[model samples]
Target chain A: MASPGPHSRFSARVGGTPASISEAAGQVMAIAEAHGYDKAARFAVRLAVEEALTNALRHGHKGLDPGTPVALDVEMLPDAMRIVVEDQGPGFDPAGVPDPTLDENLNRPCGRGLMLIRAYMTEVRHNQRGNRIEMTYQRPAP
Target chain B: MPSPESRLRVSQDAGVTLVEFVDRNILDEANIQQIGEEISGIIETRPQPRLLISFANVDHLSSAALGTLITINNKVRNKGGQLRLANIDPQIYDVFVITRLNKLFNIHADTSAAMSSFQ
Candidate 1:
């Protein structure tokens, strides 16, 4: 197939460790820079991805082996990026997550990861199992 | 004065403790935890700590880091201290805005403004 205008894809079974998360996020961001995504977009994608991976290992893989690896998929397009993160742990209801923006919850730490992932990504979808998430960010057409 | 293990550069100006990040990205678990512990240690050193955390060097931060900040804010408030964040990059500041943490924390444009508002 002919080049699709800086199209690129990366997939990995990333470890649950912090170093692994950083490495994976860095790779995704390097592609973002190479594809000419602006700082804001890179920040958004990085934050969302980090939150997703951390949540996967911390919450999804809870009580399981700490060495469990989560699935990460990144597709960098000319004007957008799509990312998916899936963990082996049982998934929970995204609706059940309390709103961190609420007055009562504002002072409380934790629970902002999913909220952020939603806010930054153009679109977010969770698999029926809830263990898998697919997020997309589409840049405005110039 | 920052310890070798610290992710923050800590100092005092007047009565306020000015804290800056040594790392460009505060997005990971270990880094955020260490930063939290270091700031919390500062908070514990004084009865009424006036802390100004500047994000001049932080290029990215995750929600976990935000959680750590909240924890620090709680500790500061519990001890009658104050916490102010300054010099946040516009992109990173949007993370605060998106999560509505701007309402939860006292944020300022720069260190000078944050330090002045300490009292």
Candidate 2:
């Protein structure tokens, strides 16, 4: 099979609730499979999406309502699948996020989300505001 | 009694608290929090708990869940307890390796191996 084509693209505005995130993530995963994404690629996409949306609710909208909505867009190409998760909150600095791998932070229970995203995804970028994250998952050759 | 929504299936084997996940994807926030609390409660019940978490059923995991595991690890350490993780699928194992958590955790290839390492 070829890469994930444009015809397989979809977008959803999902809340932070478990049901909402599961449904949205399921849809993207199914589409990815239809486009011939392997288990590893599908796994990466799912983790990145969950972490991005969860970050929006937990960090970006900390004091805000948990039900506040965020945008999740998945676009597929022959070579890569791009996902964007944007939240409606004051953005922070991505560079300021301390390295989770540091010896001091190894026991820290949080902050590894962003690091995982950066590690798994072929590419990860945060907007100037830092509330929006765009990630690209490069599909491995068949 | 564990809550109806309990995400873990826990049992006792040779003085060890063996735990497994009920869900395939341990990625949800509320569920992760509940699992953390439940495991934490188990850790508190023993003077020095020996916890062995198996990932046989878990297919997807988020960093939040990793945090929960770390928190559990810390609690186990503070209580003079021990913790072991096993049966992680290849994909999920890669996640631990990338986050450098593999270095921080005592991981085994299977339940038997982890169980044996407890002493």
Residue pairs with backbone atoms closer than 3 Å in model 1 (clashes)? none
10 residues in a row with least lDDT, candidate 1 chain A: A1-10
Correct interface contacts retained, every candidate:
0.90, 0.88
For B9-65, candidate 2 gives per-residue lDDT tens digits of 999999999999999989887889999999999998899999999999999889889
Task: Give the per-residue lDDT digits (tens) of candidate 1, residues B2-77.
Answer: 5787888888899988999999988879988888888888888899989899999988888889999999999999
Model 2 chain B: weakest 10-residue lDDT segment is B1-10
Give each prediction's root-mean-square deviation over alpha carbons.
Answer: 2.9, 3.0
- Candidate 2 wrong stretches, greater than 4 Å: A1-6
Per-model DockQ against the true two-chain complex? 0.87, 0.85
